[model samples]
Target chain A: MFQGYTAAELTSIFAMQGFAGLSLFSVFVLMALGLAIIFGQMGVINMAHGEFMILGAYVTYLTSNFFSEHLSSMFSLYFFVAMILAFIAAALLGALVEWVLIRHLYRRPLDTLLATWGLSLILQQGYRTIFGAREVGVTLPDWLMGSYAITDMIEVPVNGLFVMCLTILITIGVYLVMQKSRLGKQTRAVVQNRAMAGAVGINTEKVDRFTFALGCGIAGIAGSAFTMIGSTGPTAGQLYIVDTFLVVVFGGASNLLGTVASAFTISQAQSTMEFFLSGSMAKVLTLLTVVGILMLRPQGLFTLKIRS
Target chain B: MKKLQDFTRNPDAVSFAVLAIVLVFILPTVLEIFRLNLVGKYLTYAYVAIGLVLSWGLGGILSLGQGVFFGLGGYCLAMFLKLEASSPENTAIQSTPGIPDFMDWNQLTALPWFWEPFHSFGFTLFAVIAVPVIFALIIGVAMFKRRVGGVYFAIITQAIAAIMTILIIGQQGYTGGVNGITDLRTLHGWDIRTDEAKYFFYYLNVALLFLVLLVACWITKSKLGRILVAMREREDRVRFSGYDVSNFKIFVFCVAAAFSAIGGAMFTLQVGFMSPSFVGIVPSIEMVIFAAVGGRHSIIGVVYGTLLVNWAKTTFSESFPELWLFAMGALFIGVVMAFPNGLAGLYTSYVKPLIGSIRPLLKERARLYETPDKGGPDMLNRGTAQ
Candidate 1:
């Protein structure tokens, strides 16, 4: 499969594949980061995290529609608007779900799993009812569309570059908020020791809600970026949700850096496998390996929570 | 007199005979066939739910993989039915030889190699029970023996189901593809069209349900059940006490798989069609829902849970179909949030007290009537077991 290229060309091939993987990693991180906050921090199994992301995708869809009809030529920048809009929309919905349904079942972790699963089904069917069962195509702005020519021998898709940039911006933004800000301090404090944080006047309830909302918000951003590469349907989020959970789990839910590392590892492996094998085979192989490794390290790739 | 009273009053033994007789001889003759069919279907669900109660409620495994077991059994039975129906001797509504209809579209001329054993009823039956148990045992030993629990366990099993579905879908030439093995025929050389045959199946399911229930009751009453429930409550204690926790988990998982297979066989016989959806994540989750809503800890709850659940499915789907999912969402949230024990739990904790309080005013309808419905709460010492 690799005979045609010279040494320079082969280096460029490596570079191009590396670029492709980085973009995929970017998407995986954006999705898993929010799940890590919810499942990792709060100890709540939020199965409807993907649907929350889909809500973001829907916001992007609506934004694009608004751009096409009302703004006309400004369509080139609809993605920029869509990304922010999706974040707020998803965050608002996340907060609403937190207050209305999820808040009621805090102590019972397994119940949340079943309840959220039902919520996922409801959202899926609701989307089917509203958006029609078939997948809707979202139009990308022409300027952001197509590929970037890295070299004569290698080419990378431009949209992939765009997704990577958004991922970086979101990651840094999350990093700043988590590391530098007061809210970040409180959030981490609460995650480490909820009772102590409460005793220390951290307003842990607010932190919980905000942390959950932030994760949902990030998931929404992921959904917005996902419109470029994937289908936007009632079940579009389902495709990402499993792999997202896998990344989150494999990365170890409590650690952000672990998420990024595992995301790159799994995506690179999956993509490389896809190149060698078929798509389903790649997924099967990735999942089987993941399941096997998880059995060995049940706390995930990175362990937390006592008994060490 | 004491021996005779003891023999007559043992509810598990008594209920078994009563349920079998009513289902076999009485219900078919008295009620319209429609109601009988509904009751018949509930009996099959009861069988499935009992397996879930043991696997999830007792063993604390909370297996979301029962659907895969159910599908294995259903396909096994469906294969036998299809083979028997497709034979040259059977003339009515003839299907092509070796090709289930889905395979016709997929352009398959011959039977897949894996499906050859299913041509024989005994082999199909054996595969139904063996396949699911074998898969669970391999996966269980791989994962459970290694001590994977909680969310990771559920997610991994779910992924297995998803991957298997995708594999089955991709292999359209084999395994009946997505549409699954349908058009079931005569069971054990008896035509399924006759009302008598339907009664036979319904009775068979009822008998099987009673048998499974009895087995589950006996197991729950046994030392193993004590250790399994104890393991669920506190694994460290059991481990410290010299019991191998993984061995107990694997044992119950296999038992659960076998029961689910039996339920699947009964399900196919009643529903008259078997589809890939039997093994999908939805059905798997729904089984969990059934167990959850019916009180996962209670065995008798299994019967009421499956009945109430399927009843709700029929009612909601029939009456207000669009709002059903939302209602279902609310139901899960409600059951989990408000009532951890589900309807069965709700009944025992709230309704029983209110009824007992009210019963004093009614002045003994009988000098003493036996507890109805959920009387067997303490039969196998379940409350104490936990």
Candidate 2:
């Protein structure tokens, strides 16, 4: 398909597509991180995970509106405030849902899928009622609007770079929390053995609620980052749910490193293919490859060697 | 008197009678042709729900991609009907006289290879059943044999559903795109647009539904059904008992797919179009809700559940579109939390007992005029008399 392209032109195309794929990788990693924590560690299928992410998006939308209206001179700094507020909003709701809906469905994972789906429907409708059904876009501050020319042929969007930076910061923060923090240690203890953790002085329920909240909070941050690249709508969250779930599953549900690796692979393959095939076909091929690989390697790309 | 006792005692017998009365006589006589046609459309979903009862409820295989099979079946029949509708004489003005209109619109001059066999009615009917079953076999074998069950299986099936919808929509010329295969005029020279034809189709749909229901009931009653329930509860134990658990799961999954395929084929015939809208993630999951609301384990309950939920959807969406999602959301939560067994469980627990207590009063009235020798082996009556 690229037979006619000169060597210089081919290199330029690959660089541009590779950069675009990095932006996509950032989104996938953010989405998959939250899902991996909730689904892999907690064993709850939060089908409404996307809706919660959208909740963060809406919160960011509201925060942006507030800053632009009242503090127009300081609007460049609005994104940081929006990200914090979005995390808190999503985490609070996550805690409440864990208490009310998810706790009862802990034993029945399949039922959790259905119930969360229902919850997603309510949340989507709620978003439509409040935000209206039309897709909403945030006004990127002037500094974040333009692209940087890395040579004449390879230009990178400022927002894409910003999103990648945010992803890297958050990913490191999450890694430190999971591996180094006392709460992370307790959370892993509860996941490994609930009754034993409870008996050993850890409040298992509290750990569960916190872990779920933490997962949801990251999703909120992802949503906050999402505004820079894509528009938000009531159903926009849904468009990413299947892909997010696939990434998490394909990466090995419990492995954070695997999630990141798979996200990069999927995003690069898809974005590269997008240059050759139509957009929908690219998506189809990417998803088909993931599912086919999953069928052969049902345990996914990585597995912990823990005996059941 | 013995027969009466047996009728009241056997839940299956009572359910059969109720289903027969509703589908065979009451619905046909009371509903107008248009409403009857709507019921027929709802009944198509009942097939999918019934399939879920076997696959998810019994076999513990929750396939979130039942819509793929449903669409395959619908498109198979739709392809034939479409080919018949777009006869060479009907399309003499087009660049391609024998090809479907969508193909011609896309500037294709020849019929696609896949659509050729669908030109025959016999092949179309065979394809409707065979296609989905074959597809199910492939998916079922791939996943179940590898021990990929539960949420992982569900996510994969869902991905398949998403892929199918995107494929159908993307290949507009071949699959008719988002508009779907519209303007389906006839089925084997019979004009299906008329009210008379609608009435005939309704009966045909109802008859097919009952046949599927009977097959479902038979499966539930058989020894294989016992193993399915066992496998669902403790798959390891079932496997240790010398059964190939994957084969049983595959078998039930295929059976469910076949049932759903029949429903999809009927849906195309009754609704007059086949589209990707009905073959996507949303509709596929909604089909699960029907089974859930009906009592996932109850075959008869799912049929009623499908009708009632779809009816509520139609009425609620018509009257107040904003509130329907709230109601459906509440329904899902309510069903899972409060009534996991669904309406059938409520009926069996509360209503059936109430009826059982009231039945003795009627039996007492009958006993007053009957001789002792005529009582036969009525255990309840015998105990009461003693």
Candidate 3:
């Protein structure tokens, strides 16, 4: 397919492509991480996962507006505050959902799928009602609004770099929480053997509530980051849900590392295809490939200890 | 008739049979044109919901692919209507050539190859049903055969439905894309715009609903019905018992596809239009919610669910458009979380007692010997009845 590009131009394209792909992968990984935590660990199909992300995005939007209007001097630092606020807001909502509705549903995991799906619709509609049906544009702080020029022809959006950095920070934070912290140990114990964890006084109920909330909180952060690249509408979360699930399941459910890997792979493939094909076709091709892969390996790319 | 005995397995048969007879004879004349049109639309969705009830509610498949089948049926009929409208002898075509108004704006050339068959009404009707069934059978065989169930099954089906929506939207010239197929002339030789024709369409919807509900009830109580339930419980156990679980799934899926196709046909006839959004994930999920809210396991539940949902949609949207979806979402969550048995469940828990207590007085109609009509083959054991 390559025809008119010189070596220099080709090198520049590849360089710029890497930045775009990595940033996209970061967003995907963030979305999938939350899903993997809930679905893989609890065996609950949280269909409202995308809605959680939207809530987070809305939080970021609100926070940005607050910072812009009330404290303009801290405008650059506003994104940081917004990210934290989004995570907390989304997490609190998630916990409320867990305590109120999802608590009764752990016993009926399959029914939870329908219940959560319904919950998602309700949340989407709630947002639509309050915010209006049209999409909202979340403005980026001035410092993060521009691009970085690597070569004469290769320039990368500074926002993409910011997203990549945030992805790394969140990944490590999640890893430390899961691998190094007491909460992580308890969560792992519960996921590994729920009955045993309960017998050992691990409070599996609390673990589930926290895990679901944490996952939702991460979704919010992703949503906040997403405002940089995409529309923030009632239905915006849907555009990412399929891709999010593909990443989570295609990698290994419950495996953070696998989620990240799958995100990179899918994002790279999709971005590469976009260079040669139209946007919709790229998406179709990417989904077809994921489906084909799943047909062969139904357990997804990774089969963690508990899953087959 | 002697064949009435075939409905014995279905507990609701007596009521439905009596209702159908009355409907066939007099319901149309009694109902107003406006009410008739409304009920017609409801019936089409009812058919689609029944298909979901059988596949997802009863069978435990949570199929998000009903939209795919609905689209297949809808697009097939839409093509027929389009061809019928744009033909040379047709009055609409005499004024304008090549493209419908929507496509005229987009700059389409000749008809796409796949659209060629729909010019004939016979072919269109056949394709409307056949297309959805074939697609469902192929997809279901590939999926259910692999023993996919639960969230895995739900997600994949959702993906298929999503992709199909995107495909339809992208192929604007052939599909009418976002706008979908609208501004139609008539079906076969009848004028769609006339109140009489609308009444006829409504009656057609009613007839199809009765027949489909009868078939679904029959199948759910048959040998295949047992296997479907067993497959839901333990597919391997059924397979070990010398049945092809995959084949049963494919059969049910195909049957569901046909029901959905019929729904789409009735839907298009009543609306005089079919759009891409009609077959998207939202509609598919709406069907699932209808089944869930109505009580997934019952055909009667399907009827109640569709009516409840459509009523809420129209009423709420008119009063408060933005709040409608949220209210619906809340309704779905509330129903699923609080009333797992759905509204039909309330009837069983409460109303059935009243009916049971009063049953002795109506004993004259309740026949003897634990049998229905008489000596005909059990309706369900005959075929993939549902």
Candidate 4:
């Protein structure tokens, strides 16, 4: 595939594609982080995880609109406010969903899948009703719009760089939250043994609700970052749900670091393949490889040596 | 005659016979030809639901990629039909006279090698069933043998569905691209587009459905069915009992794939086209909904569920496009949360009791006149029956 390119050209091509893959990795890690918590830590298949992300995107959209209209002087700073509101909105709904629906389905993971799918449909329709079916683009502030040129042939967008940095920060934040915090300790206790946790005076139900909300809050942040790279739409979430799930599953569901690693590998492979093959073909190959690998190694790429 | 008597003795068989009569004889006679054809399309989905009743409801294997089998079956049959329709004389104006128009449009001068086998009706018929079963076997053996199942199996299957759809759409020249294989006109020199052919195909589809239903019933009633139920409840217990659980899972998965493939072939015949739209994640999940809503364990209920859901979808989407999604969403949530066993469960728990009480009252009334003297013996017989 690279036979026609000179050595210098190939280097530039690799560099540019590598950067593109980095941005994709950012999105995948951001999306898969939340899923790892929900599906891996909690064993709850939140199929509507994508919809929660979309909620964040829409929130960012609305925030941008509000800032442009009302707070013109601080338009560049609106993104920070939008991200916080998005997290709160998504977290609140996530808590409600956990209480009303997910609590009843803790034992039946597959049923949780179907119920969340239904929830996704409801959310998608709700989005369409409120925002119209058309795709909405958030107006980027001037500071975030341009690209960084690295030599004659390699240029990377500033927004992409920003998303990557944000992904790193969030990833580190989530790791700390899962490993070090009091809520994290309680959540781990609940996941390890719900009955034991409850007996030991930990509020397992409350921990579950909060854990779910935390996962959803991360998804909302992912969605906010998503607006910088792509237009948001009612159905855009559907497009990425399977891919995000694959990243989580391929990474070893409960392993946060594994999620990041798998997302990086998948995104890099897909982006590089896209340079040589058709976009659809690239996606098909990447997903097929992931699924095939999973069939052989169902525990995924990484696993902790803990007894069931 | 003894076999028939034994079948009649089975309650499920008896209910199935009633359903078969209504679908095969009554429905066709009453509904217009177009509506009947629509019913046939819905019945095609019933095939997938029936398969789910076995693989998922019975065997504890939830395959989200049933559409892969369904699409493969449809595409196999459609390839043959397209080949026949694109004969040299029929397509004399095209650059590639004998090849399908899509291939010609894509500037292909010769038919693809894989497409050649589809030219023969016998080969196509074999391929329709074999292809999906073989595909299912590959997937089933790979996953089940490794003890990968439950949500993992569902996710893997979903990924396969996504891959298959993308492949079909990408390889446009060989697979007919996004538009799919269309304009299917004749089947072995017989005009399939005609009204008479539609009626014939509908009956043929119903017959195939019954055959599949009987096979499913046999599987469910056999000792294997008991083992399946056991495995579903507690896999370790079943395994400790010396059953090769993966083998049974693979068998049921293959059977479901075959059933779905047959339905897909029938769908192509009745609908006169096969497309990638039916072979994706959304449609595959929707097929699961049909099974879920119909009481996944009951074959008859699933068929009814498919028809009812599709009918409601058609009516709602036609009249109020926006509301249809909400209704569908509610149906999914309601079925999963409120009525886990679905419509059939509702029938058994609520409706059957009402009927049981009413039937005894009617019997008591009858006993008052004709069988007043024999009431004690009749009550004894009823007690024995219960």
Provide the RMSD of all predictions against the true structure, rounded to 1 decimal.
6.6, 2.2, 6.9, 2.9
- Tens digit of lDDT per residue, candidate 2, span B1-386? 69888887888988988888998899989988888899999999999999999999998889999999999999999999999999999989998898889999998888889999998889999999999999999999999999989999899999999999999998898999999998899988999889998888888888888899889999999999999999999999999999999999999999999999999999999999999999999999999999999999999999999999999999999999999998898888889888898889999899999998998888777766575576654654777887
Residue A251, candidate 4: how far off, in angstroms?
0.4
Model 2 C-alpha lDDT per residue in residues A197-289, reported as the tens digit of each score:
999899888999999999999999889988877899998889889999999998998889899989988999999889978998999999999
- Residue B265, candidate 2: Cα error in Å is 0.4
Chain B of candidate 2 achieves a TM-score of: 0.95
Candidates sorted on TM-score, descending = 2, 4, 3, 1
Q: Local error of candidate 4 at B205, Å?
A: 0.8
- The CA lDDT at A287 in model 4 is 93
lDDT of 4 by residue, B1-386 (tens): 66975885577867888898899889988999989999999999999999999999998899999999999999999999999999999999998799999999999999989998888889999999999999999999999999999999999999899999999999999899999999999988999999999998998999999999999988998999999999999999999999999999999999999999999999999999999999999999999999999998898899999999999999999999999888888888899999999888988999879978896787577566665565455664777778
Q: Rate the local accuracy (lDDT) of all candidates.
A: 0.79, 0.91, 0.81, 0.93
Give candidate 4's error at residue A109 in angstroms.
0.4
Clashing pairs in 3: none
- lDDT string for model 4 (A165-232, tens) is 98999999999999999999999999898899999999988999999999999999989998988899
Cα lDDT of model 1 by residue, B1-386, tens digit:
56856766574565456556766778777877667778776666566677777777887787776788888887788877887766654533334444565555666666677767777777887888898899889988978788887677787778777767766665655666777777777877777867777777777787788788889989988998888889888998999999889988888888988988898888888878777777877778888887787888777776767777877887899998877888787777777878788766887788779967875655343223453345443434566778
**Full-model lDDT, candidate 4:** 0.93
TM-score of each: 0.87, 0.97, 0.91, 0.96
Q: Where in model 2 is the C-alpha error above 4 Å?
A: B1-5, B372-386
| Backbone clashes in model 2, listed as residue pairs | none
Ranking by DockQ: 2, 4, 3, 1
Interface RMSD of 3: 1.6
Going through the candidates in order, their DockQ values are 0.52, 0.85, 0.58, 0.84
* Best candidate (score: TM-score): 2
Candidate 2 yields a Cα-based lDDT of 0.91
By DockQ, is 1 or 4 better? 4
